[model samples]
Target: MATDDLVVPEAAGAQYRETMPSFAQERFWFLDGLVPGNAAHTLQQSYTIVGPLDVTALADALTAVVRRHDVLRSRYVPAEDEVRVQVDAPRPVDLPVLDLSTEP
Candidate 1:
């Protein structure tokens, strides 16, 4: 989930509420090894950072990062509704960009 900002309130039970700095968060999920005749196990990773960012630059950087890392380009095939990892092409993908910015 990508959001412009995330505010966490301090002193929830107290009469006064203070809003702290917002953060940008990124989430990733990975599934590996099926259970004996069952579904595969999954691994999830999430990251949060606090600051202003250029979305386009960030996306480009993320693409470069993914390209640099072999895992992101890996593919998976479905087996009985469960996905199994497969070796895939290392080529970078041209993902469609969502226009979050309005024209000047």
Candidate 2:
């Protein structure tokens, strides 16, 4: 039999509401100010596909994901004494595809 579906918890309130940064975000902001160009707070991910891939379709898929998720297009703006979260309008995601298939 199939296992029970995982229950995903939702945020307690409305979506895209104006709000200030959390403690962690505040700390990251301060640390970023102290150490510019630090990769400590950055997250990197990679995936490999062994079959034929459509570059345009992949870009469209990524753009669709950004359109559906507000956080993907969010930016931090400095306020009076703290930083505020600002959600930007979803736009086309510029995904550059490099053709390295000829490399041996």
Q: Pick the candidate with the highest TM-score.
A: 2
Off by over 4 Å in 2: 1-19
- Which residue pairs does candidate 1 place in steric collision? none
Per-residue lDDT tens digits of candidate 2, residues 18-97? 45555687788888878977998689999999989988999999999999986687677788877777666567999977
**Residue 24, model 1, lDDT:** 16
lDDT of 1 by residue, 39-101 (tens): 333467887555665766766777788768645654444555434334333444465655544
TM-score of each: 0.34, 0.64
- Residue 49's C-alpha lDDT in candidate 1? 51
lDDT of each: 0.44, 0.73
